[model samples]
Target: LIATILLYMGVALFCGCGHEALSGTVSILLNYFDVTKGPGGGLDVFTIIDILKYIIYGLAAGFFVFGVLLLVEGFFTTGAIRDLYGEFKITACGRCLTAFLMFLAYLFFLVWLGVTAFTSLPVFMYYNVWSMCQNSSSMEGANLCLDLRLFGAVTVSEDRKVCTGTEKFSRMCVSDELDLTFHLFVCALAGAGAAVIAMVRRITLSSDCS
Candidate 1:
C-alpha cells in the first residue's frame, strides 16, 4: 500500500509538471517562430496545442480515479485489511475484475513508456539548443541554427531558423522559462518511469494474489 502511494505520487508529479512544461514549450515556440500561420497545413499550431492540452487534462483526471481504485484494491488485498474485515473470499467476479485491472495497469505502463520517450524528444531538442548557447564563445563563426520545421512546429517550406547569433535566440537561451521548462520535463520523465515501475509491480502483485 505504501509502495502504491509512492507510485501514485509520481503519477501526480508527472501530470502537473508535464502540463506546465508543455505549456512553456508551446509558448517558446509561438514566441520565437511563426507557427500560428503555417502555410499549406490543414492543422494550425494552435489546434495541435489545444489537442495536446486536452489530452494531458484527461490523463490527469483519469490517473487520479484509477489511482484511487488501485489503492482500494491494494488495501483489500493486504493482510491488515483481511484481519480487520475477516478473511475475504475471492469470487469469480472478483477474480475477473482483478485480471482486468492487471491488464489495464500493464496497458498504462506501455502508454507511459511511449509518453516518456515522446517527452524526451523535446528535452533532447532543447538540450541541443542550450549546448549551442554554452559553446557560443568557441563557435563564433559557425551559423548555429535551430529549425522548427524539423520538429513539425511549422509546415512552411521557408526557414524558421533560430540561430545562436540572434538576439531572440540569446534571450531565449538565457531566459528562466527555458530552464524551468527543461527541468519540469525532466521531472515528468522521471515520474513517468516511476509510474511504469509501479504499474509493473501492481500487475505482479495482482497475479500472485489471484
Candidate 2:
C-alpha cells in the first residue's frame, strides 16, 4: 500500500511539474505578445528575447494541460469517486445534498466557459486593431497619444465627451488586464468546485452498507 501511494505521489508530482511549466509559458507569452523593431535590430530594438517569450508561452500551455491530467489521476486515486458513491447511499438528505453539490460544480464550469467565450470575441478585435495601430505608427506603442484608443471606449458616458482620440499602443496592456480577469474567474470556479466536492461527501465508499 505504501508503494502504491508513493507511485501516485510521483504521478501527482509529474503532473504538477507540467502544470507549472505551462503556466509559466502562458505568462511569458502574455507578457510580450506584441513586438516590433526597426531595421537592423537596432533602430526600433526588439530582439530574440521577445520571440522566445511566445515559445515559452506555448511550452507552458502544453505542460499545464499535462498537469491537469495528472491532477485528475490524483483525484481518482485518492478515492473521491468511492466517497461520492458512499455518500449517495446514505440517508435521503445525504443523497439530495450530494446531488446539489454536483449540480453546483457543473453549473460553475458552464458559467465560466460561457462567460469566457463571450468575452473572447471583443478582446480579439481589440488586440488586432491595437496591434495594427501600434505597428503601423512610428510612435512607441505604450505612448498615450499615439497607439491606444480603447480606453476611450471604457469611459464613454452620456455626460462625458466622446473622447475618440485614443493612442494606438494601449491594447497590449488592456489584453493583459482582460486575461487576468479571466484567470480570476477561472480560479473562483475551481475553488467552488473543490469546496462542493470536499463538503458533500461525508462517508467513504468503503463504509457503505451492502
Candidate 3:
C-alpha cells in the first residue's frame, strides 16, 4: 500500500514537472481554469517546460486511473481473494464493503446533480441575463455587442449614448450559462440512472449469510 501510494505521487510529480507557463489569451483561459497563475509568459515561448495545460490535467487524471487499476489488481492478488496466514479470508468482508460504499456514492451523486442543475439552470436561460448586464436588460447572452448586434444586450458610446443600432465600440459580457444549461441535462440523466440502483442493500459480512 505504501509503495503504491508513493508510486502514484511520483507519477503525479513527473506529470506536472514538464508543464511550462504560457501567456496571452490562452493563458487567460488557463488561469481561469486554475491551470497556472500570474501574468502570461513574456512572449512566444517554447521548451520542454511549455507543456500544454490541458494535457497536463489529462495526464494527471490518467495517473489516477492507473493508480486505481493498481489498487483493484491488488484486491485479487492480495485483497479479498487472498488468505492471510492461512487462517482468515477477508474476501467476503471486502466485497460487502465495496458494494455498500459504491451504492452510497451513487445516491450522493444523484442528490448533488439535482442541486447543481437547479442552480446553474436559470443563469444561462436568458431570464437571468440582467444580473450580468450593467443596465436594466435581464436577458441571457446579452454580451454579444462587439460580436452580434441583434441580441438583447446593450453597449454604449464614448458620450454615454445607447448603442441602439451601431457596432462602433461594442460592449459585451461573457457567461457560462449556455454551457451549464447543456450540462444540466447530462447531470439530470446521470442522476436519474443512479437513482435506479434504488436503495442500498445490506451485504453479508461473511461468505455465508447465516
Candidate 4:
C-alpha cells in the first residue's frame, strides 16, 4: 500500500496537476534535457525527448511482436510450442524485444552517423570559392571546389560577401541535407530509447514473475 501510494505521488509529480499548464510547473521542475532553439533560433539541438521517442518506438515494436507471437501460439495446439521448444514466458519475450531494439538502435546510429559524416564532405573540401573569378582560393594547386547550391543560384564575391552574380571566391557549396541528417539522428536516438525501455520491461517482467 505504501509503495502504491508513493508510486501514485511520483506519477502525479511527473505529470503535474490536471489543472496545471504543462509549460508551467513541469517546465520548471522536469525540464531536464529538453532542447530549445539553437544558435540564433535557427535549429533545435538534440534533447532527451528525441532519445525517449526512439526507446518508445522500440518498446512499441516489441509489444507488437509479442502480440503477434501470442496470436500465433494461440492458433497452435496447446502444448505444441512447448513440445517443440520450451515454455514461453513474457519475461523472456521482453528480453528478446530489448535485444531486437538494441540491434535496431545500433543500425540507425550507424546510418545516421554515416550520412551526417558524408554530408560534411563539402565543408571539408572547400566551403567558399570565388564566384566571379570562379575561384574561392588563390592558392595554387588547390582542388576546384564542389558547389553545393544550384549551379548559378548564388555566388560569393572577392570581398567574401554573398551575392547573386558570379562573384569571385563565392561559396562553392552549401549544405541543406544536414537538416535531414539531424532528423535521422533524432530517429536513431528514438531507437536507443526503445532499447532502453525494452530492457527495463524485461527486468520488470522478470521481477514480477519472481
Candidate 5:
C-alpha cells in the first residue's frame, strides 16, 4: 500500500513537471525561432501541444482517482486489513475486480512506456542544440544549426527551418529557461519509468492477492 502511494506520487511528479516543461519548450521555440511564422507555418505544432496538454490533464485526474481506489482495494485484499478485522473471505466479485485492476495496470504500464519515449524526444533534441553550443569554440567557422523541420515541429522551408550560429541560438543556449526545461523533461522521463515499474509491481501484487 505504501509502495502504491509512492508510485502515485511519482506519477504526480511526472504530470506536473511534464506540463511545465512542455510550456517552457513552447516559449523557447516561439521566442528564439520562427516556428509559428514562416512560409511553411506550424499550426500543427500548436495543435499537438494543445492536445498533449489536455491528455496530461486527464491522465493526472484519472490516475489520482484510480490510485485511491486501487489502494482501498489493496487494503481489503492484503493480510493487514484481514488481521485487523479477523479473517474475512473476499467475495468472487472482489477477486474479479482485482483481476480487472491487474489487467488495467498492465495497460497503464504500456502507456507509460510510450509516454517515456515521447518525453525523451524533446530532451534528445534540446541536448543536441545544447551540446553544439558547448562545443562551439572548437568548431570555429562551421555552421552549427538546429532544424525544427527535421523533428517535424515545423514544416519544411528553406529560410526559417534552421537556426544557425545566430544571436537567437546563442541566447537560447545561455538561457535558464532551456536548462530548466531540459531538466524538467529528464525528471518527467524518470517519473514515467518509475510509474511503469510501479504498475508492474502493482499487477504482480494484485495477481497474488486475487
Candidate 6:
C-alpha cells in the first residue's frame, strides 16, 4: 500500500494536476538529440535514434516492474503452492510450479508492454513540417526544423504541413493502445499477486484443518 501510494505521488508530480500545464514530458528529452534543422531540410538521424532509444527505455521500464516481482519471489520461497494443488504435494518438484509459472506469465506481459510502449511512444508524438518553394533562391539555402510551438503542442515546420492532423491522430491512437496494454498487464500482475497471497492463506488453512 505504501509503495503504491508513493508511485501515485511520483506520477502525479510528473503529470501535475491542473496548476501547471505540460505536454509530452518525455518528448522534451528527444529534442536535445534532434539536429534536423538549418537550410538543408535534411533528416535528423540523431533525433530519430534518440526517439528509438526512449522507446526502448519505456519498454525496459515495464520489464523492470516484473523484475521486482522476481526479486520478491526469490525472497519468499514457500510450499503453499504445492499444498493448494495435490500434484505439487505428490511430486517433489511439482510443488509451487504452477504458481511460479503464473507469476512468470505476469512478468512476461509486463516486459512485452514495456517494449511495445517504448517503440510506439515517439511515433505517437511525431510531427512533420511543410513549406512552399516560391523562388529558386529560397531553395538554395533553405532548411526546415520542427519547432515545438506550445511545448509539445504542435510541431511547426517551414512547409506548414503540420503533423497535427493525421500524425496527431495516429500518435494518440498508439498511446492509447499502449496504455491499454499497460493497464491489462497491471491487472494480470495484480491477479497473480493475489493468487500467491491466496495460496499462502490456503496453506495456513490446511495446517488448521489437520
TM-score winner = 5
Q: Where is the poorest 10-residue window by lDDT in model 6?
A: 14-23
Candidate 2 worst ten-residue window by lDDT? 154-163
Rate residue 9 of model 2 by lDDT. Answer: 37
What are the per-residue Cα lDDT tens digits for candidate 5 across 7-111?
787788899899999899789878887566434644577778878889989998999888987888888877777788685777789878888888888888889
The positional error of residue 138 in candidate 6, measured at the CA in angstroms, is 18
Candidate 4 local lDDT, 3-107, one digit each (tens): 223323322322222112222212322232122334563322233334434544453455445434433333342355547657655466655655554454445
Model 5, poorest ten-residue lDDT window? 155-164
lDDT of each: 0.80, 0.38, 0.37, 0.35, 0.80, 0.37
Ranking by TM-score: 5, 1, 2, 3, 4, 6
What digit string (tens of lDDT, one per residue) describes model 3 on residues 37-100? 2246532222222454565577468547744654564444453444455665547776665655
What is the Cα-based lDDT of residue 102 in candidate 5? 80
Tell me each candidate's TM-score: 0.90, 0.30, 0.26, 0.25, 0.91, 0.25
The candidate, 1 or 6, that scores higher on lDDT is 1
Please write out the lDDT profile of model 2 over residues 1-210, one tens digit for every residue. 332233233333323332343343244334433322335665221243344336435534653453344344334435566677765444666555445534543553354355336334434544554555445455434432322124322122212111113532244335544344344434433433332332223122212311
After TM-score superposition, the amount by which residue 140's alpha carbon in candidate 3 deviates from its true location, in angstroms, is 65
How far residue 156's Cα lies from its native spot in candidate 1, in Å, is 4.1
For every model shown, the clashing-pair count is 0, 10, 4, 24, 0, 10
- Cα error, residue 37 of model 3, in Å, equals 19
Which ranges of candidate 3 are over 4 A from the true structure?
20-51, 84-210
Off by over 4 Å in 2: 1-89, 137-210
Instruction: Flag the better candidate by lDDT, 1 or 3.
Output: 1
Which portions of model 5 show Cα errors greater than 4 Å? 37-43, 84-87, 161-164
Candidate 4: where are CA atoms >4 Å away? 1-90, 126-210
